[model samples]
Target: MSPLASLTTILTFISVVCAATSWTTTPFNPAAIPLAVRSPYLSAWLAQGAGNALNDVWPTFWTGAIVGWAGFINVDGESYVFLGDPDVPNASFQKAVQKSFEFTSTQSVFVLSAGPVDLTATFLSPVEPSDLANQSFPFSYLALSAASNDGQPHAVQVYTDISAEWVSGDDSLTVNWTTTVGDTITHQVQLEDQTVFGEVNDRIQQGSAFHSTLNSTGTTFQTGQDVVVRAQFIQNGVLANTQDTDFRAVSDDWPVFALAHDLGTISAASDPVIFSIGHVRDPAVEYLIANDATQNRSLFFWSQISTLDDAITTFLQDFPNALARADAFDAQVNADASQISSNYAGLVALSIRQGFGAIEITLSKDASGQFNTSDIMAFLKEISSDGNVNTVDVIFPTWPLLLYTNPAIGKYLLIPLFAYQATGQYPNAWAVHDMGASYPKALGHNDGNDEPMPLEESGNMVIMTLSHFQRTGDNSIITTYFDLLDQWTQFLITDALIPENQISTDDFAGSLANQTNLAIKGIVGIKAMAEIASIVGDTARSSNYSSISASYVPQWQQFATSSDGKHLTLSYGNDSSWGLSYNMFADVLLNTSVFPASVYDMQTAWYETVVNEFGVPLDTRHTYTKSDWQSWTAALVTSTTVRDIFINSVFKYAADEENSQPLGDWYETLNGDVEGFKARPVVGGHLALLALQAVRTQTAMPAV
Candidate 1:
């Protein structure tokens, strides 16, 4: 080959590599996903739009939820109270996140009008529109009242309040309606002050903040061009201070471009927002569900967390005795806080954000008199925070509380583990398939990963089960499931080859053939199982496991390193070409007693090298990293810097960034924008008991 041609080919190859690596998930926006999150509340967001949508931020709950059409969107500025039991079959609140949007467009599809805008909001149920808490009866009002230069009132198009349904069951009554536009605006119209509750909404016209000439609670006005308007209900006097006192309550704004003047010229130059609103049910437990062309659905995490946090705060008001006060809080604060503060809250968050649920239970009971354990393992794995199997086809993974928080978690953990032994039912194996990538739903490639993950999963199960036994000191559960021990051992020996491609949770970087880390994990799993078998007096299997584990150490080292430096590569290459995070768990998670301490140093160095403003990126390629894994990886070492770096990583992702929803999993690194995923249980586990706290065993969850 010619020298110039060779150089040209090399240059082309280098360019291709750079190009592929340069692309962020959504390449255009810098504030795009992959940065860090500034909002911390998203960590607890788990509500799947039960009431109003959630917002993401410190002030707001999650970023704003996509309530409906852009025109009829509500801010995450409202507060939500748990009115009914979330654990109940169907639940609703008397007053929560008090807010709704009603919009109408004079143009094509939006409510914004270039010439004039008038809207009539009919309450589904009304009762003189007096007390704020008296939402039991809806009320009606007119807003966004505007007119043209011709000195004529714009057409008042009235719409129904579709949100005024029963708290749970189907019982929606049309609230009483009233009009206080012209003459009524000058008078109270036998109702409370409009300004007291809140302004209907702030009005603006074509980038112009429209100043209202009419101050009545329900009145109309004339405008020269298309305008924007906001409306809010009135209810603040202590006498009138009712149950529904959230600020998110307000009407929608109609944005339009301009109005045609007598010269036949368009003025103001604002783009009219084309949008629509409608009533619809949630999608079935299926994919590719259709959405109202005008309305989009976005789950809120930030807001959900805040509301939950508020509930917890309320429950903790009588701290040192939350469970003792359960009955009291139950009636006053009630199941709202209890339901949200417990494991269910975490689980709900996980399912929405990541797709699976995991727990670490302590073997103790709370004041509620409930004792959760291994028998409930399968349910624990798929349990949503709000309480139910997710309709979606996926699940997620977790970290410390390393699947070791409460005994309730144990019952859940064992469900899937024993299913494999009893019915050979691999479907609900309570253990994880990998480190959380579309699970429980078991959609897409996750299904293929199961039986294929024999060693990885079997080993994990053995370790977890043994850990549970050590913590609880109960050998009976093990005795009852000895047959599972046999199958698991065989699978580890025959199926656990370590190319790392078909390895455990560490598959995110890509496939590595014959990975040392996995091999070590396998050995540990075998040894741990052997210890269990010995405890049960199964001497034959114990010896076999010990022999295999003893021989595999050298092989682990052989394939993980090449003829280069002492440090390990991402794979078995002389290059030692690396990745964002290092393979530190090689000796750590496996409980390897005799590995080099240098491994920790080298891994920490690798972690440092991958650092970004948001966190250490997934690899050298980009800025974004997973908050959950950062916690897990940090748990392996004892360095405060290591621990803090990972902790701060999660902190950065949680506190700043896009969609300030209370908590969501995926976040951006460049500008701290929230990317995807919300309120996952795995994140709770990741955040709840990181580092040394992992190995410690507590039998039950902390009191509420």
Candidate 2:
């Protein structure tokens, strides 16, 4: 069924059918607690588990930067802390128990019971694809609903506060405040001489955060270096099922700039490369007038509003429907996960949420002033680790989720590479490995002393581009970039069969001469190009590439196969060692005849033997495994039993108590311990099975 129709059915019978999911076995520990994950920049999560302690550790960015802390609740003149620090206990409150922690596609609800009162704090950052106005809106809603559990009338009050540390990288920034005519308050906190996307540096950029409260008493002050905004309310003589205050937090990097005009391109010897004039926006002003509709842009994120009376009023007025949509989306995701397996339902739920949460969409205005979420003029991938578009290799794992959500987004992701190249970003024959700019900037390839992974990235780009075409059945995208694809294919034709020792995507594992697995990638890429050529009616070119790819299959099988036939060697002319020849598995996934089914069976059987307690290693070269690539290899297995063995193993790793970070992509296979690269968007790679399923069933991909 269509997602909308399925959601409608769920909403119709929700009360009767929807049962609350308890997450005690895999409790809501703070390895990942997504509170506000609207974009890469607006994302917030808890670093430490706050199960029973209301006053827990401060919430932080994926970079481990502190965003701030919020806590405290009062009932009838007695106080209780439910969010941050609870050591200074309150008289009227015993320790609150987190009864249930539930998540949807667009919302998270935490059920907490304190004394006789039951509270549901629903955190909503509506990501409804059907409503651009709500999706692009920067603000997140912290809606609190309270009721009497003991069936007695009582006066109740609650308080939540955020530190000014949220606005800028430096907590010393001066903050100014304003109170709207309505029941609202706004704080404009920012650093001095703000520059958005100026230099490509690794330090987190300083920006503005507008904190506002709706229908509640608000206060702002400086407590040491922290700027604190507190919103508290009292419902006199409260009855059961009463709604209290709602808090809104909106953040943006204003003076946003992007390359608008194409700079003329020349050669590698050309001195002093230049950039064209760009667009600069005042995010604060834009926030005030986002609803005007007269100032529309084609940018990814075009919505932001201050605590002005009209802005707060509109948000509150439209919140009911927005929230309803979020609940419906949640129900749909939950229902879908349940169908997979009760053991894996939560794992799937968290995976889907974390996958989509890593991307950031910025806004841009067009000539017509019509807000265009469709154009996605600026699709930014935040380098929570290194702040580079760090394209090709990094985006390889993320392709599965993007393909399953919208194949168009897969095309959109490639646009930046083309855009950077058009402006002479990199002077390479194949695809650019990584755009040099640090996080929040997409200027160009900026790694000063980095070596380009010609084979790794080129193979990745071609394979992903072809996968996008297969899912979308869109021939135009391939045609538009045919020249680029042809150039890369020709490069692969030359170097794929006999690769020189060079840095690959897995550079940490060091270089390898005649890398066998990488050769498979090039082979798969060539075959994909042939398929694309046929789709675009280039019969002669298709025939030429088909023969080229076909020749490599047997050559690779002969050289890469271990003498015992138990595994494939990691490199050519070496039969003792084996690694993930994951790229070759694509032939089976694409239903192509390039690689024989025996190749896949042999690799799968060998991997099962090597499986550790956590997962199969990335290769025989290292004990560390990548969750994303592991998923790709696991999807290649034909048997459901074999596939579940791998999937559940990874699921257990995700639920492990020690690996306490947001989905670490790299980890030790034996102990399920994180090695490095934490909280990355590559976690989306775990959804590769979804792409395989979509292709097999010919089902419409889910809208993320």
Q: Report per-prediction Cα RMSD to one decimal.
A: 18.4, 12.7
lDDT of 2 by residue, 443-465 (tens): 45433333568888888877887
Q: Report residue 617 deviation for candidate 1 (angstroms).
A: 3.4
**TM-score top scorer:** 2
- What is the TM-score (0 to 1) of candidate 1? 0.48
Clashes of 1: 121
